[model samples]
Target: MAPPVEPDALPSPFAGLPGALWLYRFDAAGRAHVLDATQCGIDAVHAPDHWHWLHLDLSDARSAQVAAKLPLPDDARATLLSPDSHVNLQLDEDEAVHGAFVDWAHQRGVDLAVEGQLRGDDGIGWLHFALTPDLLVTARRQALRSVEAARRAVGAGTRADSPVRMLELIAGRFADTVERSGDGLSVRLDRIEDRVLADSIGEERRDLAQLRHQTVRLHRPLTAMRRVLKQFEQRHPAYPEHELLPAVARLNQRFDDLDGDVATLQERARLLQDEVAAKLAERTNRHLYVLSMVTALLLPPSLVAGLFGMNLPGLPFAHSTHGLAFALLLGVASSVVVYLALRRMGVSRST
Candidate 1:
């Protein structure tokens, strides 16, 4: 047997590489064993039939150093250390696959570009990864939710003999989080629809707006991911022979379905938004109708008061002893006449 592993040893060739976070190895029997810390050389770790995975934090200052020390192909290494957040997968001439993917993550002072997070509104993070036959490497500026969940699953003895399989597992975990979010949106839609039917959308316009925004955020990245994966599959179907096709196909199908669901939610929100606008317009029209009727009724009385208040020499009520009473009666009669005319014309009738 090999010597007992040291807990404090770092994956070596470069001393004190702080970016390295987690390391795992699969033996010839294909079981995952967490290598807490290792001083092992990359070549020694990659001997004959073993598979290894190293996860790193690119937010750390040693990102370049760690990428340089990786045994991955140059293109794969570049992908792992790239600070740009755009998603793409490329197959290197050496048969390594590398890409950046959008992943959900909580924020904590990451030293990376803005696009890496979930549109800067949600905690969406980018996961940059590269995979070879015997090794898988993933680096990210911020901590990702799916990456951590995959670690948990591995701790629970999840078996993935290949880097492709591990990648699939991490993607599946991400889909699980997305499914929960979609289900929540559906539930919220049901409540919104109920309120719409009951005519009690007190603050639901604003709520629905937030829902639509979240759906858009989820939709845009998912679309780019699905589109790029499909394009990669169609164009470069031969390289990475054993694993790439099925993995891309599976991810494409899963994300396509998810993108469809988000699109549906967006459509539903649009329709509800229109309905809310119509409802608000109808309410405004009713209030305006009431106000116009009140104004029409008061118009004649206002005219009578204005005419009486003008201090002209030959004002009709000015010489009468009962001038004040006559003026008051005239104003009341004018208002009543206006009210009767409006009633007769059906202007006061409820719709």
Candidate 2:
């Protein structure tokens, strides 16, 4: 299992805060520069020619204080501060675009341990965003894969010249995360299929169920995001002709395809579970049938022995010197008759 995340062991950037914060500024040439949040003033964010992206971790108490000081519209501010916000997108009265998206918090092989420790918000997290023409602010209560991806991209000098474009890049990151998850699930399903074909299912049912659950969880958020993206496309205040619009449309379609794939995989897992159950039942029935046939073959012999052993005085061959031998021969003959009769009627054949 992975070691626990110690409170005091966080990296420098996230130290001494309930959550981490990062600031990025874009220059006229579309180059990105990482800035310290403590050093950036409100005037820098409001400059007409400058574009900035701010990411805040809302899990910390101080994040509330930091968020209160930003020049955000009321609805956008509410979204960032509301703990119960769900996956959605909307335009505030001031034309600021605000939305929430779902992301995998503890991705397998990223920070998740092999022994299944380090539970992460039931395998999902929420990221809320408030976007205007020049500024983009994102808030989350937990670590998100897409948010990390955007941070890495910006760190590598990728340009995000507008808030809309920044949102698109983050959405693209989300799509990428889902695509990779789907690919991994496909591999798992292939293994499960092989096990089913070989009739070697042992604990695969539980594994498939787990995979199906994860898929369902992922599907819900992606479906919500798809609807939100559709609404955003229709009502976006940014340039109606922005290239990011088409890109977002395509991204939404990709999410739809991924969601369909997850559904198919879930169905396949369910069928395999049923198949395993049926095979087990068939095996049990065959064993019981064999036992029943054995009992039927022995029934006649048992009856013959029981009758000859009775103490009746007029029983056939009861007083003869060779009575014992006669009775033994009779029992054998009766058993043979029963066995032959059963074979003739195909009662001994396996179904």
Candidate 3:
């Protein structure tokens, strides 16, 4: 009997983050016995390559790092180990990683897309179509649970035996990411709503800015993926000796759903941004009203003092002790009148 394999040696990458691999045995009815890649199996590691197998992760650094460990054919050796493979070749200190990934994909005939979003404190990911006739690869930098789930499904051999299945697996991943993003956003928005209405929460301007940045980053990949998905929908490539129409149709539905979810999130984010702006405006107006009321209140007292301080012998309230009390009363009465006027006008100017 073969010796037992260690967990680290598993064929599926990112083993700890809930990943799995599935291989399907074919029969007349379609896929027969499905083999889980994580389990010890006759066709696990060192097994021959089969069409439509999927391996992906939301935390790209770990999975991509491990994929580099996969043994490459001699012909592909030079390309596999090159620095370009580790860090996207097209990038420099000034360029973005996603931009470089796109350029590389275009050069290699691999269709790819990515979407990233930040709503409040939550991060969202939606990546699609990083596979080609030769290989399929997708990555999201953050920790996403759905990527792990899809990897588990594929490891368990639930996917079909065609490139289209690989596409579906990827599209399904984006759908999962979209759903998760929505859930997270909903939770955060709920918190913000509570704080906005209940507690005197400080401005969320910085939070809004962070969210905008995350959404923009996510939009880059999603927009790119949308293009690639459209290509799959229209061109309908043939590979792995199987029909891909069903898979492609399913992919279309998934893509539509993902797009809709992203749109909703963007709209929600904008609405929040607008609310923040309105609140800020209201705050500014309130402050101005308070300042104006204070100036009005001070005006009467300052005028009375100025009149009595005139060193002229005949100044009206200068010599009399009664005059000082009368002037004090005048100032007090003037402040009361201003305060009442402001109150009637709905100004919160009182300290």
Candidate 4:
């Protein structure tokens, strides 16, 4: 029997090697057992029937050192260590599959009380994985929702009979997060729509713009992931016989559907923004028209008062004892006439 893991000698799971986070060995029956670094001997890992998984935090220097010693293929090693690696999947000539994927990371302080409501902004991160028939390695620079969910599932005795199944589970977790985000976005859009209908659009334009940006961010990464999965389905050596191929294909389709939904939502937001602008312009034009009519009505009275106020030698109203009354009457008559003319011309009609 193997020696028991000693708490004093083992490093803390959260703060060890630059990127070494967790390790596990899963047997043929889909049961997982946590393994210490000291237990991951090369001879044991190389056993034809052995299956193991190592999760590392790539931001740690010790993780890089540990990764360099692993039996990963050259391409997989390079991809794992490269900081600029993007979301992609490549099948190496040695039958190894490796790639990076974008995953959602919940922001700190976000309120999770509501089922689909996310506070602040949605966070995004990357997860890299290298897979062989007998081994699976995963690395990340930051914590990811999907990875954590998979870990929790494993601990709960979820069946992951092979490395490929593990990958599928992780992918499915990502899909779930995206789906939830979409649902949240839909709820937000519905509220915005109500505001738009009521003509109470205040800061909703900014809100819609933010939603559009988030959708675009989500769409791009999902598109890349779908393309990678499609390529894997068509070209990877383990195509038809690979039990996980169908799962991969399903994931690809789901992302495609999500891409379409996001695109539609984005377009709807843009349309709503346009409508708000047009309504504002129309309202402004009506206000300006009303102001111009008021100015016209007051023009005649102002001119009349100015003429009478002047100290001209022979002013008609100046010689009359009832000059003030006569002037007031004239101004009122002029204003009424102007108002009538405006109404007749249809300038006062509501749009």
TM values, all candidates = 0.84, 0.79, 0.55, 0.85
Q: What is the C-alpha lDDT of each candidate?
A: 0.81, 0.75, 0.49, 0.78
Candidate 3, residue 347: the lDDT equals 69
Point out where model 2 deviates above 4 Å: 1-20, 107-122, 234-239, 242-244, 304-332, 344-346
Candidate 4 lDDT over 1-351, as tens digits, reads: 999998656644433233557777887788888766554543445555558888888877678776776789989988777775467877776668788888877554443334343334567788888888888889888777778778878988998888888988998878876778778888899899899899997898789889888777777778889888887788865556665577677888898988888788888888988988898888899999889988989998998898889988988778789999999889889999989988999877768
CA RMSD of all predictions: 6.8, 8.8, 11.4, 5.9
The reply for model 3, stretches above 4 Å from the true place, is 1-151, 156-159, 194-203, 236-242, 332-351
What does candidate 4 score in Cα RMSD to the true structure? 5.9
Candidate 2 residue-wise lDDT, 229-311, digit = tens: 77777777574565556766787788788778878877887887788789889889999998898788678878988998788
Local lDDT at 288 for model 1: 93
| Each candidate's clash count | 1, 1, 18, 2
User: Best-fitting candidate, measured by TM-score?
Assistant: 4
Compose the digit string of candidate 3's lDDT tens values, residues 122-224.
4343332233332333444333444444454655656445444544554566555555555566566667667666635575666656555655544555566
lDDT for 61 in candidate 2 is 74
Candidate 3: Cα lDDT at 289? 75
Q: Clashes in model 4: which pairs?
A: 18-60, 19-57
